[model samples]
Target: MDTFHFHLHGDVQPLDRFFQNCIGSCHAYLTLREDWREHARLIQREIGFRAVRSHGIFHDLVGIYQIPWGGERVFNFQNLDKIYDFWLSIGLKPFVELSFTPRALASGDRTVFHYQANVTPPKDRGEWELLIRTFATHLIERYGLEEVQTWYFEVWNEPDLQGIFWTGSMEEYFDLYALTARTLKAVHPSLKVGGPATSRNMWVKEMLDYCAAHNVPIDFLSTHHYCADAAFEMGEFSGIHWRGQKAMLHDVQRTVQTVRQSAFPNLPVLYTEWNVSPIHEDVYGKDSEFTAAFVLQTVKDLSGLLEAYSYWAISDVFEESGPGLTPFSGKYGLVNLHGIKKPVYHAFHFLSQLYDEELVSDAPSLRVTRSPEGNVRLLTWNFVEPVNPDFHSDYPLSGGEREEEIVLEGLQGEYEITCYQVDREHGNAFRAWLAMGSPQYLTAAQVEQLKQTAEPSVCDHQRLILDGTLRIKHVLPPSGIRFYDIRRVG
Candidate 1:
């Protein structure tokens, strides 16, 4: 049994900005798929993510470049328009990863992903600059300067991951970033541009130094972090290992601190890509109670440290390693291919319901907030790092459930308490799927049933008359989260 105390007081701090409102995907060009579009709309309507960030916007599949009979290259925005229109219609602005060199502009044959995005730098810097300038101008003219100014133009995705995402050296990446930044800024000085969107928090200080030395504009700093211990190399799944939550928190904190200590101290930091594990094939890691707990823990730890943080993806319509056939195949998405919500999705949904007003709690596992109307909310989780033998345990809740007694003082009135919980037995569709024999393919009715059961379960409402002290008891399982909303009664 663990006892915790929350002291509700008038003193308050502004809630951290919803930095997690941005989410990423490998299917940026899949906006044409009806199911994909529906999934995007559902995520927007439910979770209300503000921006969608993804790669492949400049890939040949989108048909952005053409070499005419005159041996001159022309850039087209017809497909780009369709993609942006779909996003805007769903109320999602583009975070805009300007990436994957179009084949005509590419310097070499290097490529990555199922669709084979060109990983090479442009053969000619000036031509690349023209392409960027033309694209930026088109966006500004179509969306209006004021509207486009709000969008983010991340120069490239993980340029530091040489030989995989980029075929250039670190110096070359710096040059590319500088050229891209200068070009985008040239189009409209107000256009927000930033990056070196590196994985595992690489290149923050060096990027700042390069931009400062070269006199290039950097509106924000961007990078990524995952809970895995090391970077993922192609064909290296067997070597993957969990680094635990503490390491992930330390990495993020250090990354933010690095940017803050740099010459551009005021620059906002956006973690454009992040997840519990970078190894996409680790099915259990992606679709488990541990991931949900990791989500709650990560957000709680990194809340005020960055301007924006995007989970690696919104849906599993991804195709970096090709589309996953199984529903719960350890893909990097909040929702599966069938559009069923995972535990991590429910974690964000719970977090979205919290009020901005602050309430004090010393426990690391708990977040307490007080509404301006005097309502109180407490979100707590029991998190166990998925490592070794612990990872082999099918149901994390089996022996790890613990009783928690929460005591709130300085309360003088009657209140109603509503508890929303997500654990192995609640708000976990993957676990339910396992119970149903881990079906490789599910019928429509089965899918609907799982969808209905994939939400956070609400406990029976409890009303309490408090004189001066309030105490409530809850049993929480390992990798479980509970959000308690307390409303003062009239």
Candidate 2:
């Protein structure tokens, strides 16, 4: 093998939970009522995330009593204590989205697609504001204001998109955002308030402008993204590359640049609603495993460029009803609707384990590996399975069989390298699940069984020495992701 650059030391810290839709949505879709206990237990014990972005609130397309939009299944969160209990019991901090106007408050003519979104401002702002107060009061009464305040309060979903997400204007959004922000701040000034959660970089500009002109408080910013290609469908992938991966980070990069240019240099940008939409295409069955590795790489590569990023959803929710879904509602997710963990979920778990710092040992040529010294715990996974951007589609993607090496340079002397890999044989339970076919769904019990069995097996490979270094060589597995736990044994 060849040497790369920079010795890696300290580990990277884990970000909070990645946001998704309703907890009830995931619960219903994932658990067979009987297995709810085991399902909740297994999921809660899973060390991946401590937070979740519950989707489809405040947008007014869905009612408060009903399951929020995005969830295909209609669930009544009417028993506030019941709903809150479920989440708290599972050990989750809600990234609350102040959302879709309830039908009762919606303007007579205002309503959107499947969600029946009421984009029009409430006919009675007082009533609507009261509703907000009520919700907050309930949460505080249940979870305590101090506890609930720990949650995020994003004003609304993407209002910048005219047709689908937003029927309101920038000015309207500013008004809504300001009102929501003030309400939250007034209720508990320490509560975080930042949103205008629009898509593909829409609200950043207007949001900043509004906050600046109006002097509103923004704790953190949130947004969303998807692969830039829309031409293909259902596995028709042909020419897709990890370049889009770069594009993912680049979008944040540009946002960061622009923010710095505009004097909001310290503003943190959060990718709140991303991944393949409609909740099925990008993730699900067989196509989502190798994305496991991509998950690690993408997050690691983009960590510096973003403050926080969520992978749209944890599991596919019930809002995926075709009857109500518009032209392109089939988005992607890290996991699927079955409650079984996707490769991406596993990878996310792995990435989350990385400590908050990265230190690379200074190495020779080959820009891949970092120096062996430092406090960072290095976790680099190679996706033997190409991370085709058209990841979930039915067509062939831009990656093919190939050979590559990442040299860890700048080793002072001998070092102990432990490696763990997830591939067809190790962590590819999805492959087995896929064989079960579409109608194939796992009960929470079955899902739990799989989770218990989903541990990675490690093997020791040959070691080489050069200029005070050690090299490990092995064939990267098919659709495999190899993680190196590099430590100094000298």
Candidate 3:
């Protein structure tokens, strides 16, 4: 049995930048798809993401680069116009990841992802600078300078990874960034831009030093992290290394500390991509209670460390490798291909409901916040990452139940208590699918049934009369999360 003690405090703390609101996708081209757009809108309405970041805006798929008949090479904004317009329509600003060398501008044929975006360096740096300036100018013209200025213009994605995402050396990437950043800033100084968007939280120091040395503009620092033990080797689906939540938090803190000690101490840090496991093929665990717990734990730990953190994806419409075969194909998404909310989706949704007024708690597993309207919300979770014998298992390890006696002090009057929960048996679509015999193909009826099972189960409302303190007992299974909303009534 575990004990958690919480006290309601009169002191109010500013709400930390909870990174649940910024999310990412595989490619900018996907934003043009009807299904993708539908899912994006659903995420915006449900999860409330403010900005979306994705790769391959300048890739050939978006058709931004061309050498027309007898005319010099020029930029095209047709597809870009459609994509940005759709994002704006959905109330999401772009965290534009300027990436993937366009084929026409590439010096070599190196490429990545299922879409084969050219990953080689530009054939002409001068032309690259011109392209960037023209692109920025076009965005300002179409979206208005005031509006476009608010969006992020990241130089490139994961340039420090070596040989995989980038075909050039580290020095070359810095040069590329300088050209891109300088050109964009030259177009409009207020247009925010930054990058070296390296994977596994790399290259912050080097990027900062280079930018400072070269006198390049850096409005914010951008990078990514995954809880996986190591980088995923190319051409392999090695499953998840599963480093767990504590390790992920340590890395995030280290990254933040590195920036704080750097030449640009006040520069904001944005985690352009993140997830529990970077492996996109671990379908079973990816959609399970374990992943949901990981999400809750990581977000709580990252409370004040980031300006924004975009989850790797919002929907499984992603196709970096290829289209997912099943509804729960372990692709990186908060929702499945059928658009059913997974347990992790509910985790974030519940997190979004937390208020600005923070309360003191002795338990590391509990987060307490009070609304300005005198409502109190308590979020608690039991997170246990799979290890040793259970690490290779497709399903989450079960039966680590925690019984906690929660004592809340400094409370008076009658209050209404509403609890929303997610565990192996609730708000978990993967578990529901398993109970349905792990169906590879779900029928319409089966899908509808799973949708119902995927929702967060609500406990019956209870009224409590508190003279000075309140006590409640909760039993949570492994990777279970419970959110309690308590409001005073007459």
Q: Encode model 2's per-residue lDDT on 1-490: one tens digit a residue.
A: 3224343332323432332222223312122233443434455576435556654554322234433456542423454445446666777667677766666556555554444555566656776666776677667876887888778777877676654445566887788788777777777788788887776766687678778888888887777665443323322333433335456667777777766765466887777765532234443322345555555545655645665576645444334333213111233444444445556656655554454444432321111223324322344455332344354553233444333355444455445566666766676555555444533446677666565545565765333333544444555543456566655555
Name the lDDT of candidate 1. Answer: 0.83
How good is model 1 by TM-score? 0.94
To one decimal, what is the Cα RMSD in angstroms of model 1 from the true structure?
2.3
lDDT of 2: 0.54
CA lDDT, every prediction?
Answer: 0.83, 0.54, 0.82
* Model 3 error, position 463 (Å): 2.7
| CA lDDT, candidate 3, residue 162 | 66
What are the per-residue Cα lDDT tens digits for candidate 3 across 215-236? 9899999888877746456634
Off by over 4 Å in 2: 5-44, 57-78, 108-120, 229-243, 276-279, 283-287, 322-334, 355-357, 361-378, 383-392, 401-418, 424-426, 436-470, 477-479, 485-490
lDDT of 1 by residue, 1-490 (tens): 7897766774667777555468887756877777788788877776788898989888888878767656888788898999999888888899999888989889999888788999999899988898888888988889999899999999889987788899889999988888999888888799999998998788888999988888999999989887764645662434555676787678878887888888898898888988877766777678988788888888887767778889888888888888887888888888999999999887877777778876655567787788767788888898875445223334223347768898887777889989888888998899999999988899999999999889889975888888878787888888888988989995
RMSD of each: 2.3, 7.0, 2.2
